[model samples]
Target: MFGRDWTEKDQSVIEHHDYSYIVYKSFLKYLYTGVISLPMQELLELLDLAIVYCETKLERCCIQEIKRGISIQNIDFLRSIADKHKKEDLKIFCLCLESRNS
Candidate 1:
């Protein structure tokens, strides 16, 4: 850990290989502005970032965006994501969507 009088040697660079540059940039923008608008795939990537960083608000926002774009084709995939992330709201929402469509 760097002390109060940090120097260039104390600087650190974190890397995220799984996320695209645009997705990472949008995440930083969202952190400052509390706003994000991106395609569903990018939103999913952002959701992963949020989960990794424990950003519950951003995670909720991403889930809302995913819900808006959800369809029969993507329900399973999204549900799996919800399950993987332990997002009960999203899992319940996916279930409701499935039931409604049935």
Candidate 2:
């Protein structure tokens, strides 16, 4: 991480070297407004970015949104993401949902 030696102008020019433009912009908006309204299609990618940045609150929000959007067709994909991210709670939730629908 960059140290505290940066000027305001330097800060302005400092890119979010960790995330994509869309993900970073959405995250910045969430920081400002505490809300994000991106399409479900974008949630997983944002979740990955949130995990990488150690943004626990943002990860929780993403997981909630993913739960709301889940369906039989996407359960496997969601489970895979949960496993990949070590989100055991989400993995359990997805498994329960899958069992209920089976």
Candidate 3:
């Protein structure tokens, strides 16, 4: 992590590493509004970034959104994301859904 102390002067040029522009913008908006409104693909990306950044609240929000948006088409992919992110609840939910559908 960059340890450089940020000041008002740096506000104009401060750059975050790793995240794409859209992801960073979305994250900034979430920080401001405590809400995120990305589609599934961007939500997945944001979730990964939240996990990496240790933003547990944001991660939980993303998981909730993922759950709300889950469908038969995206269930397996969502399950994989849940598993990879150690979201046991979401993974279990997905598993149950998959079994019921099958």
- Candidate number achieving the greatest lDDT relative to the actual structure: 1
- Looking at candidate 2, the ten consecutive residues that score lowest on lDDT are 1-10
Q: Could you tell me every candidate's TM-score relative to the true structure?
A: 0.84, 0.82, 0.82
Q: After superposition, how far is residue 84 of candidate 2 from its true place, in Å?
A: 0.2
Q: Please, what are the lDDT tens digits per residue for candidate 3 over residues 1-102?
A: 234674645465677677778888999899999989998999999999999889999999998999899999999999988889899989998999889999
19-67 in candidate 2: lDDT tens per residue? 5687778988988898977777677888988887899999999999999
Which candidate ranks first by TM-score, i.e. highest? 1
Q: For residue 85, give model 1's deviation from the true position in Å.
A: 0.6
For model 1, the local distance difference test gives 0.91
1 or 3, which is superior by TM-score?
1
Alpha-carbon local distance difference test for all models = 0.91, 0.85, 0.89
Residue pairs with colliding backbones in model 1 are none
| Model 1 worst lDDT window (10 residues) | 1-10
In order of lDDT, best first, we have 1, 3, 2
Instruction: Report the lDDT tens digits of candidate 1 across residue range 26-81.
Output: 99999999999999889999999999889989998999999999999999999998
Candidate 3: residue pairs that collide: none
